[model samples]
Target chain A: MTQLAADIASTFTAEGAEPFTVDATLEAGDEETLVILGPSGSGKTLLLETVAGFHGHDGTVTVNGTDIADRAPERRDFGFVFQDYALFPHMTVRDNVRYGAQYCENPRDAEGLLAELGVAHLADRTPPTLSGGEKQRVALARALAVRPDVLLLDEPLAALDVPTRQSLRDDLVDVLADVTSIYVTHNRTTARAIADRIIVMAQGQVVQRGTPDAVFERPESPIVANFTGSNVIELASTPAVRSLLDGDTPGRGDAHGNGTAERVAIRPEAVRLDDDNGDLRATVRRVVREDATHRVTLAFDEVTVESFTDSPPEVGTDVVITLPRDRLHPC
Target chain B: MATETGSGLDVKTGRVQTAVLVAGFVGVQLLAFVAAYATGRPTWYAYFMIGSAAVTAYLLDGSSFVVATATLGSVLLIALGLPLFMFVARQTPSLVVEKAADPDVHRVLYLGIYGPLLAAILSLAFGVPLAHLLSEGFSGQPLVESLVDLPLVVPHSVAGILVLFGFGEGGAFPSISVLGSMVGMVLAMAFVAAPYAVNATREAFEAIDHRLEYASRIHGANRWETFRRVTGPLAVRGMITGGVLAWARAVSEFGAVAVVAYSVSFFYPFAGGEVTAQHAPVFVYNTYLQGGLQESGAVAFLLLAVSAMIFLIVRYLTDDNTIGGVP
Candidate 1:
């Protein structure tokens, strides 16, 4: 049996008179993961709440293709994870997980779910007593315990430290399998790693929409590219690289044969220093140690490219940097 | 070592000052206590002076001095007021009703049935006159002149005099007689003393957190339930404090009660209508005016003892940080 969780198409006005619209659909059956990626106050939360029936929403929303636009939140059959992990601070982990189930069908397997999420030991502890990662998992378990038709997670990892976020993100991916989920966050990396389909919003409207790779590779506009932390580079196409940039590349050209690329984005971690001569030539400008790896900055002509390296070249040193052919995404 | 020695001297001096202040306070209280026991007079005026010293001690966080003063004050109140209350209760009336058939007539009798009832009646009769006196504007006609008019005019030996001065005509007293009536006295008492209760209650309610109310509301409880569960319990102490203050004020009202009416005393079987002096304050005042100084002082002592008890009760009830919170 299949279920359609929510079909949201609505506009929202935020506190600063800024407005945005959301047009997204979630299918209930085979794990559909949709992530709403935008800066803060871009109406991601407003959109999520609209689906959860918390906002003043115009336009139709359907669950199983039936209009549930006027349904109450409790009756909407969607479980939401708040940014601050709005688990009832007073309730034990077990009670928090059981809260949603009390409103809907009794989730007979709540104990098993908690155990499966590795938070069974913390079941007797209050939300405040749990670590950030533990709290995030408990929130996830609570959301999923009711076997909701739709799951909404709003910045689930934002409250956690970086290492905790990574561990919880992996745990979330495995636990949310075979369930329709919509996540909202401003973090680009989380969205890129988790979203099956990303809806990039700005102000109050969806500015770009596609698979993570497509959207990151081919941002519909430059603003989306900048907001998503894509290095917008102007690449002057050479004869050899131009021949390689043909029908084989999905998004390689702008319409003119001048072979002038307006903006090309390559992930910082993807570009590497090659001993052989490569297409891009640059001087090592600065090396900033971030975590265990160094973030190396290289200057080529008027553009700078940043990359992660174990042994970064010294400042004022020249280097040949190669952008992997497949990783070179021209927007 | 030199700085440490200097600071040590400072501490010693501070301790000496505190000791001197404590000695002075004890000396005053001892004098007042001796005076009260010896003269058996209105001695609490001296106690009030000692109390003012105690107030300074309390504010300075001198717990030893405060405890000492409170202990002495408590003993004085119990010794004076308890006897007075018992005497008043014994003289007033018996509440027991004997039904030979039921054999359980005493069970039906409620607590403080006569005390509160007598207090209520006194408050009304005296309160109205007090209200009139306190409310009478800075004034053309004196309050006593209006009240004393009833004795001269009503049932006058000569009906011919009423025809002379227009006293029989719709006079102010006739239209709204503030003379020789219970209603006139009660209004007077309530007017002067209402601020005591109302101000106290309002402050008590103000001290509670409205956040707790908001938290309850968001947690799916309605307004009434929120108030009952959270606000009511939290403010219970304050409310009781305010009520006690109001009650004490109502008991002690006098000036207005005297102005409106002074004729009716509480009637008794053996004592045969002693006019119970209408209210406690008027009783004390009239006794002070008419009797020997010692008798007047005795009634004044009773009033002071009751007032001190009420003040102490209010202080205890309104203590802060008694409820749950991190320090």
Candidate 2:
């Protein structure tokens, strides 16, 4: 068992709230990034905040195997980054970082940390005057400045533009390299890129948990499959997408990479466009140029298949497409 | 740096336009002034009329109308000023506000929370008379009747008498005898004036944000430290306003002080032993009823001048925008 910073069990309930219950054990060795993906009102935030000790809910949250059941937020030794960055508007960049250092026994390394975060020059600039990217960096720096045992991020990049989000996403991967973090996001792209292990939550429960590939390729529930943009098809004989065979341990019990997948995941880009007569053929329904590539939807007798191709057959043309045997997964 | 093109009117043309507008406004005022003079109307009335007209036109038409009206108004003022100057040169000095106007300094002070500080200070100065009146009681027995007619409901003279008896001979106030002393008067004034401070300070404290206090607390500041650093700075304005109001209320008090103490001599009532049950207002009133009208008017004018100065000072100190924004 890996050493986990925070362990959550039991149900958490507030006044007029439906009880939220989740039992999950995360050990330290799961250096594997855990992504909590869910829709709005799915209690993903509530779960994260509960672990951070902000929510007054029933639950046993143990950090480093020690129960912090009644501990206050400041004493939880967890760094939380809120969606809006929650940077104190009155404090400058330096003070924001220094705010957490007060909890530390000795803050001699505060200046060095600020310089490391690349915000030393902007130490005196307030949150309001800093750019969106700068504010995000300062907020992250403030959270990490505490060197918390568990880092909880609540949709950190949801407020930025796409380009900034992408750049910051890369920055976050590097910054959070050694930190035990719980990343919460609604964006599938974010979860796919950064999360080593993804947990799909619906309503108030974790529906699936595994590496990004395992969860994305073989989503146990429709909600998880749809959320990850996977084409969830119901079929007999063979699964349309990749799947792990029965009695197979996932990647020989290693959940991170090369996990044994029960269902096939033929990425949209994997399906090739074949004009020459092929085994799988269908009439073209619609072709759309999305971003740099074209998404061609082909209509078969019982199912509509989607493929991304550089060249698109005309709308009414009968086009041939193929899902390789290896890519075909069985549930 | 967005400059207003102003309907594309030529800049050079605006100068000519402004001059014409001023000339027209002035021409009309000049005509009104000349008409007033030719018609044998009181010359001072011309200044008032022209000034009112210019003010009205300026308010309604902005700068253009103001310039026009002021051109005519200035000439009218000059004409009126010369006559006013000659009149002042010949007339004797008198109270700006008269008894006919019923200019009660105490009443205004109470109504606006204005002159309490001045009243308190005067109470201190006239403490001897204050104590004398309280010990001797009222000879004319007018204190009771005057208390009803006084500006505020509290009989200031009665308040003075209480201070004297409490702090004077045969007094409950053993070591203190404001009974014919400045100390007693100050106590009485403070008693009356302190409420304004208490009320204003309370209000000032209420206006501060509790969040700022919370932030200070979370930052590890104790209650007193939080109050000193955040609450105190925030409430300073209200505190000052309250203090000024209280001081003004204290200084302007008269009836209570007059009833409790009277001057030894009527001529120099301000002298320690001179102020008595027959205080400045009583003397001023008596002069009006017994002495000639000149003496009464002079005293009334002196009171008016002093009260007006106090009122202006209080108004300036307690103006709006006194509190700074917290966050």
Candidate 3:
């Protein structure tokens, strides 16, 4: 069943800046976590704010088929989590959590919500004294206190360090399991981890929408592939793409009104090294250590492709690399 | 956290530049003072030095500016302050005490003290809302801002004349008399002191993050409640400091207050033969005219001592308890 639906169209104009329009149609199901994934300046945050009634826009917003497009922001019943946490520095964590109770008909206990978010010990402390992770927990608890109909989180994990963001992202998986939400972020990993359905936006428009596996494994365009961390290589002379290019060109397709599809997106993990029977030969350019493996940059004549390996050969070494047929997607 | 190296600490600073800039600033001001003395324009140069120095301090930019500004700024402060300090130091304490015991002197002190308090309260009441409105900009915003600062630039006597013409009898309202009345003195003082309150509060409002207010609004708070609960506490310190400055300006007011009321008459009879009282500056001017510098200097010293003590107390009270801001 559809929980909320919106058709938003607005031009964001700022002083000394060119205006850009954010126009999109969105739908969220009951108890679903829908994520909006986009690069910087793609207007994902603007879309969230417009739907929450913070900015005036041309749109029809409906909840359970009831039109609420003209309601003031205070009456929207949408909980907004700001990027900077926006915790009140003067109020204690408990008070910040309990603040909206005066405006709501039913609010959860502040202390209980804090405990649920694992921040009960910080209830008496002010926001300035809390760490980034603690502040995020408190902000979440504060938003949840009023039992909002939909939570609009605007990159709440972006400001934290890696470990804290990872932990919070994991916590969000459980916390949002039964809540209808629309989380906007530039991080594709966060979107993939928490989304029931994902919308990819570019230039303030929705370019693609699908489940995580479908979107990540079979991106339809270079914009989506590049933003999702795929290495899109132009196949001008590569013999490996000749068979795949018959009617599935990824880039610079023929001018018989054929769409450009000669560029292929190859995941880094798919490029295997030290394959004795491999069909391609490359030289290692750079090797950098990642979490548990080495990221090897391989030179394929003129194109540079990246690969992750457990044991990488030294740079300046001529290595045999293989592009498995199944791993290449014509995006 | 800076670690101590052999030549310097780990933290980078512009200490040498600050020292050089401050030294040059002090040297220039000292030269100006000597030039003032040689040109025989002592009083005019004194005002020019202090005003120019304050404006220069505000203009000084780049890193390491704070210490440099304080060092350069202190010279003019001390230069003007030295005479007032010596003036009080040379007065006879016994004579000042004797003058303080007089009922007429008591009336002058009361009138001088209460007039500025009333003026500061009036400024806070009217200036804060104007400041809040100014912060949320609109067309002609610069004009509105300059209008708020109009009271600060106009001559004090001219401000007095303008206030009188606006509210006095046969000018704007024939039934009202803003002459030789306590209301007249407060109005005169407020006319010259309101800029400090408005400018300071406006700055405080500008420094706050607007997202906090937005957060409140989305959490079911209307605009008024958001301002009352969030905006008010965050800007309280600036509001208080502005009020203090306006109070100080009003207390030191002379030309305007005197124009409005040279010697204000009490409504009912008092214990003594005198039925009228002058604000502190006017009282000193009157005493100087009647008995010369010796008698008036004692009263002046008494007023200075009391005002300094009260100012210190207020500064201490507002020193702590800063509240509200996004971390």
lDDT of each: 0.61, 0.61, 0.83
Best by DockQ: 3
What is every candidate's alpha-carbon RMSD to the true fold? Answer: 14.9, 13.8, 6.9
Scoring only chain A, what TM-score does candidate 1 earn?
A: 0.83
Q: Can you give the TM-score per candidate against the true fold?
A: 0.54, 0.54, 0.84
lDDT of 2 by residue, B162-205 (tens): 66666677887687655544455446666566545555665666
Rank order (by DockQ, best first): 3, 2, 1
Q: What TM-scores result for chain A when each predicted structure is judged separately against the true chain A?
A: 0.83, 0.82, 0.92
Docking class of 3: medium
- How displaced is residue A235 in candidate 1, in Å? 5.5
Order of all candidates by lDDT, from best down to worst? 3, 2, 1
DockQ of each: 0.05, 0.05, 0.53
Interface RMSD, every prediction, one decimal place: 7.0, 5.6, 2.0
> lDDT: which candidate is best?
3
| Candidate 2 positional error at B52, Å | 16
TM-score for chain A as predicted in candidate 3? 0.92
lDDT, candidate 1, B93-125, per-residue tens:
121111212212111111012222343444334
lDDT of 1 by residue, A1-331 (tens): 2355555677754457655666655433447788889999777877777776666566766766788788666566666777776665545788767755544556636688888888789989877678888887887787777777777788899988988999888988876666778889999999988888888887667788889988886675667877777666664534334444555443535566334455567778778898777766689999999989999988877678788899888899899888777776666
Q: Give the residue spans of candidate 2 off by over 4 A.
A: A1-32, A108-111, A234-266, A276-279, A325-331, B1-327
